[model samples]
Target: MRRRISVAETAPTQPGTTGSFTTGEWWRDAVIYQVYPRSFADGDGDGMGDLRGIEERLGYLSELGIDAVWLSPFYRSPQADGGYDVADYRDVDPLFGTLADFDRMLQTAHELGLKVIVDIVPNHTSSAHPWFVEALESPSGSPERARYLFRTGTGAAGELPPNNWSSVFGGSAWSRVNDASGEWYLHLFDTSQPDLNWRNPEVVDEFKSILAFWAERGVDGFRVDVAHGLIKHDELPDFEGITGEMLEGGGNRGPMWDQDDVHEIYRGWNEVLKAFDGDRMLVAEAWVAPAERLSRYVRADEMQQAFNFDFMTVGWNAGRMRDSIQSALATNRAVGATTTWVLSNHDVVRHASRFGLSDPSAWPKGISATDEQPDSALGVARARAATVVMLALPGSAYLYQGEELGLPEHTTLEAELRQDPNFWRTAGVDIGRDGCRVPLPWKGDAPGFGFGPSGSTWLPQPASYSELAADRQDGDPLSTLELYRRALLLRRELQLGRAELSFNASTGDTLDFTVAGVRVLANLGAEPVELPSHHEVLLVSDDAAVDAGQLNSNGSVWLR
Candidate 1:
């Protein structure tokens, strides 16, 4: 019973062509898809995803109608925190593929007219990194030790940590070294990931070379990981305030986060991005907020875009959604930068499952198998509605892999199979993000859902995934995958990404707005709402939710 609409065909632009937009500004309203390499696909039957896996899927991404693909880190790493704990910034991990495999993937993506955005981790390095290894070998105050934050402990025998700061992954942020000096080092996340000293000139110069290294190889952009944590207070200070694994908004600023000096680092990085062709750009994965303050990171000469986490944190409420959208648009407008909208990423529980929870905002870390489960049916309906509203806004939209398939978090993942460090670090209390990062389902009946030739996956998929596999939904008009395809096609044809938003008259729990002369109506309340009269129905989030010109609860509709 799903409604379908015909969209006029338009010739596709060649790769590297920025059509209609100002030169080098394709990112302004681009729809970029986040690809977590480890969970996307496994090309070699090795029970792990690799560059060859992604290269094999370039055609799938192109067919998905995204403008660009932002790959999560696949660099050489111990993967203590996935690829965030990078050991070598310039090389691909053997667990992923060889350097040639990366080039081949990059080449294939470009040939498919998809821009490539690589993740850049600058705030820290794996303990096994050459710099960190040398720092451990060197004595206190040695030049090698200067590369990282290694300070003498405070107790009589230098036993206590230098400060009271806690790690994002739990435990003390400072870990005492076992060397002669018995010094302690800073690691904001994990013991294996050491925080680098941005005050060092060598660190700054090294990142510039790394940027140029990737830029020369034809990446269209870089998604700077932990973008706000690069520069810390010169004198590391104690922060007694409660800290979570991720910053939710602007109020959590402290010695280790959102420092003013961080802008200098990004400004220098912007200069490096400008030197490349094809409108090379940088997007910050900064969790800093108070939309106004977050604006500073996207100033003319800084990063082109920063993730708008505020929008994602706001629960399934019409007023809250409207406020977030308006605030993001107004703030970015002040800095002449376009806003970025994201519903879910690898670090958090998938939005589909979150929307199903009684208190949607309660479990950002994730849920365990024994935890209170969400209403799966309601979650998918609400997630579909939310995505429609997000896509209608005038900004760049980022889609996490499998979201278009309406994939929910693997909340039932067994504790024994969990690999997220947060789970172990918190002694299973935090549950961790492994549920959302489970390998994607591609084929319904194939081994590992066609993720690999072998019937093995790094993380097991739920039994329900077979029904939601790409092959099962490939040609089904009512399937979530098809819904995304149709929506994306309309988005490009209508130029919704470049449209301006204006709220229409609406009452409680119902959001009515217009973008580029198209009316978008979302019903968040339990009561059904009447659709705008005399307009052609362009799309609906749930087919059954719309009946007799009325949109039922947790449904959204587009009309022209």
Candidate 2:
């Protein structure tokens, strides 16, 4: 419906032995780990986390050399906002289990080669979804209340709320409908959820039949949820001075968000993910703004990837991380697409306590045990030098579940065991996202550290998560889960996700570059630097004092 295509010969390249084009679309440069399924791994001991606790942690995400896992929303939810309020995009959520435990956890994450990706909210549902309880007993403009965004109310007699759009978990984004037939629905997040109507064709054949019922049950893609808010602005306008600041990407041209009819609903969800043959992908948690309008949701045909969030909201400087990775590789190379890189997810702050606080751009939207605590050993040394500069940056890199055990953000959570709807829609003075959604500790020392087997953890795992447990840094070679398992096994023995980075001439506060030719560096100065004339170190977030040639200060290297 919006056709502006050119996917560069159906995109997928990855064969590289050094020639540098790299897209064998295994999500082009794949490292993707995210999880957050009720705080990953609780296998039936039931402190939550299920799907047989992610099939007993698919061998700990295939020994952390992750190639794909995503998860985040075990569907059928009533967990209000945690599961992003969904209600049944075809089942699961008996608190996460069954559809035969999600086909035995997608057949053990495709027998451990991994690739799962799930989470597809489609801009709202779960007002107890039976089509929102039959559009709350239908009749308003019936057709079962035209699949959602209900309307019909605008002041006195009708009683206000047909405009001034708000609620991203705060207040008035419509709601009203309790009978008297005065109607009003919308819900840009939580009045139990609602909001569907993408100009309803029965909400586009019920999400293309919920994306062919999870791509015929193999599910290799779809992170969508609020992917640029499903088509709005046909009229309901009235947004002046809406300082919700477009939820942080800050440009705020909000007509209920990035809506060029939401790229014809992602080119009809990239034709339901190219009718699945398993190369399937989708990625857009689109908080769209100056980040080159997220390259029209990864255009070529639509959504092949979209989550740079301007390199996860830039600011741990080095010329603002090389101008936000050269404006996200010139806006995803103007649409050929594939440039993901992330740092911290489950909605923010755990770039190891936002790189030890002191105003890492005032991270706000919730974080307050009287705030200012950060600096836990300088936030695990700049979150281990920002995960070796986001896994040597070339393309895909997601990793959020416990940040490979470098966990951090439990920023003092306790307002009655808080649970994020941005802190009950700001009633508690915004201390939400339950300190980066706590819960994963995995193994000994107390209180569900093992996250189940009845240790019982539904968010409170702190005491410094017993030294970032995963059985105390699984074979700690100076841990951070063995530096993300030796930088994802040297990012696959140096294919470096199909390599090609470049940059080089940097000096103060380091960050030099190179990728196919390897190099990398980083420092972001406070101290050490001098490195270059390489030949081999391959990976080193901090080899205990690493300096025969320097690089330390918040360290990160990769040389070769």
Candidate 3:
């Protein structure tokens, strides 16, 4: 019974008035592909991905049907926190490439009709940054020390840390400087990364200049790192009931994160973006609480987008997913901003592995090799289904590198290869994120898998990766890469991103919705479920055969 509904059929085309993409507000519903430079490709065979690698891969991204590429930081650094500990905001790290290499990458991307968004870390700077170096040299209470959050310790001989706050990685957030004064400075992450004093006018001015420097070079936007943490409560006080759950964007509120004054900094950045010639944008990486608080970061006068962690971390339940979606959409709508949907990124476990767990309702802080492993077959199936559902939703989407190839987290990464500070600071108790950050496999049946001409990669590729390599899946109609490619192309053709989503029907076991004439259904229950009336089949997850309009359990599809 393949029932065709003519009323649901509509011509496939982009919604709204057509114009030069440059003149349009392209980011409104854009599909932005996130490129983790170190793992994407290796151009110079340095066993590390660099600007040249990204330049070479621009055509691949374009073919994947992405509107823009958001690159992780390649700024000069000690590599203390995988480029998050930025030492120089104005220069490229030699490990990644030179400024000339960056410019060429940007030029090639623009020529291919893709916008570029660079990561900007304003919340903290590497200890090697000139400002931090000068602050360390100056005595406590000096003007140089004022550039950062340096405070006097509270114990006898001032031995104890200034406050009881703990780092997101591990241990105390305040690190005692070894200068004669023996004062302490704040670092919410690694000690090699020192928090900047936003209260200081010099810190504010320096960041403004950093923004302009990149804007002049034609970057389309910025992804603000730790966007909610620049401001702190004036009185540095000890955290009383702070727990780990509260640290990673849970229902926690405190002095160090999601402060009111953070909005002001983004407002200032918004003005700078407005002054630019094109429709430049700013997206926040603020790991803030409850859906409502996340909305505050994207107010009309602030940043344009913030990662929807609520959607990303919610369990694989129909009821839970629907609730998260409704809440996110309603909240962002109040601020006149589009909701952003993301499943996984560089900092979290891949949703493929995450969904394979018995219960994926709440994301764990970290995954270790010794931990209970995921069901690989189940995980891959769910991941493919999830992609179709995500692309069918309203608002913008972010696709992490290697996800389109259906890669899973390398759960067995050796301790020696782990680089995330969370792993080192926690002393192997937490596996950190190196599993999801493994170098991508491109081709061949062995190590590196075409990541470089010399077959060398920073992180070892598993034997299992050979089947999932890009070259192997390039033309396979049933491959995850092709599924994403077709879904993305169809998303644009149907104008799904710009269309308003409506709940057509839903049940305890199944969730159904319609957007831009396409019906999206997800079967969360044990038994196969029947889809509503539609004119055509768009896509389906692994093994989900749409015979007689029935979608299999743990499967999803797009119709009409």
Candidate 4:
């Protein structure tokens, strides 16, 4: 039942000629790897990951078989929200590298045959940004103020916030300014990040220029941060209920979150992307609800792809996962856009740890040492199985940097060392995203695990990281890193990304599907499932799980 398939011998049709594949549509089924600059690798020995770090590691990504690299924001910032609060859209943060360093990195990534997609935070900018500083100095009705959402307070003597909207991090979304204007600015995220008034033609044109600046520098695409939040209702209204985290998409979002007008902005952005020579693309980080509404962001004239948050947040159960997949595919098919699947990212808990939780759904905000601990061994097994299933699906896929190494979150990070604004803003109720953003361990015994020469990191690494370092797993056949290498190689060889998928008969606790003549069986039940007859195994999450004709619990296998 366990058989190794030769990737070199496979000659499946290329993705360029298959399902949803049109001429020059490389993004339709590309495998993009997300690099959190602060954690990927440290090249300057400055205790932080930088552009130089990314450039030096380009070969690692190339060998990993990813089609593109999606780097989180490295724009000039005060590090208010870990670079999400950008101070200057055109320049690189000194903490990351100079503009020249970014250009070099872009050139290197392109040379490696990997497209580059940089993060663009259009919804808000850091308070340190010149526009925001000028807006603060100008009077309430001044043109500088018009570029941002500055409004008079609502209460007697203008003491209360303009509306009842809450910040996604915590507290009121409105931040009062102590100045002659005495006006309050809106910020859906951290206080340092003031929301840009999309209604202002100046703001709209400025973002278009910013996009062109990067595209001209040869960045293949952009991942629009808070893509659904650029637009808001003209009448700033109060929410019907409490708004703890607006990014959690479901049901009907309130006025400030996912307004219908947001798509208009993207439609215009699409025009900008089309003007570029390369197939420059736009990917929405929108957390909009109902698969149908989410699809609207990826229409032919709009963005090409949007992160499938629904699939990432789905529980480990097979029934829910199956439903999520079916719904996503059907909606994207209607829009003629490729579906992008993601299981882990910089924001959420790594799937490696999430899968081991007693309540896997409870840790999106994050987990702490004081909280319920995950069963690490069990989590790794389930995560591997889940990845195999995700890789076999049609369309594009995103891999969080350390996921292939089975790196778990630093769940025990102490409070004093935490840096995410979510932790401070929420008054410690939310542990924040720091645990998942810890520096990567590259070597088993090297200082700082070869993350940097200085052997220091912004966030502390757990002792367990040493065992899972990349060097330790590099050539080990049974390692998670090798498994990913093999899986990605086979995925490309079989053209699974361009293959159509069909559901097969299976019990509630199991998922059975076929893609390009290859059958994928995932056993999420408590017991093993018998394999289908007359099929040779191509790959498996765990070799021990496949024996005779049975696949063990929380295991997955591919057959042909």
Evaluated at residue 437, the lDDT of candidate 2 is 77
- Kindly report which residue pairs in candidate 1 clash with one another: none
1-560 per-residue lDDT for model 4 (tens digits): 46533322232222221111234878988999999999999988999999999999988888777888999999989998999999999999889999999999988887777889999999999999999999888888999999999999988878899999988888889989998767899998899999999999999899999999999889989999988888899999888755545344443377876788888899889999888987888999987778998998999999999989889888698988998899999999998989999999999899999999997555458899888889999899889999999999999999999999999988999899999999999889888999999999999898889999899898989999999999898867677887787778778778899889999987689999999999999999888788889987778887566766888888898899
For candidate 2, give the lDDT. 0.77
The list of candidate 3 runs beyond 4 A from truth reads 1-23, 247-252, 543-545
Candidate 3 residue lDDT tens string, 20-109: 254477888899999999999989998999899999999888888899999999999999888999889999999899999999999999
Candidates' RMSD to native:
3.0, 22.2, 3.3, 3.2
lDDT of 2 by residue, 432-513 (tens): 6778877788885866888878888787777988878889888656677877776777677677766778888985667888
lDDT of each: 0.86, 0.77, 0.84, 0.87
Q: Write one digit per residue (lDDT tens) for candidate 1, span 140-259.
A: 999999999998899798889998888888888999998789999999889999999999999999999999999998999999988988888888888866444445553356788889
TM-score of 1: 0.95
Query: Among all windows of ten consecutive residues in candidate 3, which has the lowest summed lDDT?
Result: 11-20
TM-score of each: 0.95, 0.34, 0.95, 0.95
Model 3 deviation from native, Cα RMSD in Å: 3.3
Better of 2 and 3 by lDDT: 3
